[model samples]
Target: MKINQYIRQAQYKKGFASIILIGVIVLVALGGYFTLKAKQKSSPEQTSTTATDQKVYTISDTNKSTTNQLIAESKIIESLKTNWQSIQALIPFRPGHPGTVAWLSPYSVQFIGKNNLLVGFEDGYNPGVAVLNFNNDQFKILETFKNQAVFTFSDWQSLINKYGNSSYPVSTYTVSLLRNKQIVSFQDLINVPENIFLKNY
Candidate 1:
């Protein structure tokens, strides 16, 4: 009877050990499956967040660049206006026609080096190009080509191609006055349906 009880106890011990081993294997497998599932679920969310961040950064950079460009353009326009005003003040228009009355056409202003500029203006009467030189904080008329015909876009392009060589830096800005007296850039004028080459002469 003692021997039989000992055998039964040994069999019970072996069964318990098997159960524990099987339980450990099952727990390990479940842990691995859950970890894999969690990683798969988080990956898409992380990718989406990263993409959103990149898009936001790109838009911010573009806005900053656009703002800076607009500021620079405004400064250039102000400088052009100031210089033109100074020139008009120094060289008064003939009697009965003020400088303000003589500047009623599309104008092209080009800033050359060494504080020099070339300005083309068309006023119902006098339409031509003039070279302005800034010296000692004062503006002086270097040369003037008066009574020129109205030049179209093609004409201006032809002139530029004829005169502007690879060696010459011909950076310029053109502006036109609207019927409402509002000044607009030449680039903007091209998009309008109205004819931009309305000759006063």
Candidate 2:
């Protein structure tokens, strides 16, 4: 009878152990599933591509990709232009204090993927693009392009033709292209892609 009792106790312990082991496995699997789900929800594609107060574009060359880049801004046309691609990304502002941007002026800010750009203005206030040039690798703000915001349909049409957008967001924006304060126009601009000059530059 004692032998039987001992056998029964051993069987009970084995069964209990089996139950505990299976429970542990289930708990671990559930934990892993939740952890993986959390990670999947936070990916780079879900991240904002633009810089603070700027539009961010991921431009790729044949062999390389650039990020946070600041390029020269101009009113010229480009055949193969690299813009925000979507005017929805632009943040227009009226001119601010010169210190609004770290390296440039305080009129408008544009994101050149890897670099933050400051756009300057001629009137020291207003939202407009400067046809800029580059001297010794530095951006030089040149001519300013302005539409009357004329409060008229014809005025709207003119801006739409120039900026290539009839529905661009209108606001007081700021950025300053850092270069010779006296320089203006795309003529002196350097590092500009030829395609930008050809079509929608």
Q: Count of backbone clashes for each model?
A: 0, 38
Report the lDDT tens digits of candidate 1 across residue range 97-117. Answer: 345453543366654445555
Error of 2 at 173 (Å): 23
lDDT of each: 0.52, 0.35
Tens-digit per-residue lDDT, 159-185, candidate 2: 345433333322222211223333222
Residue 21 in model 1: shift from native, Å? 90
For model 1 the TM-score comes to 0.37
Global CA lDDT computed for model 1? 0.52
**Lowest summed lDDT over 10 consecutive residues: which window, candidate 2?**
192-201
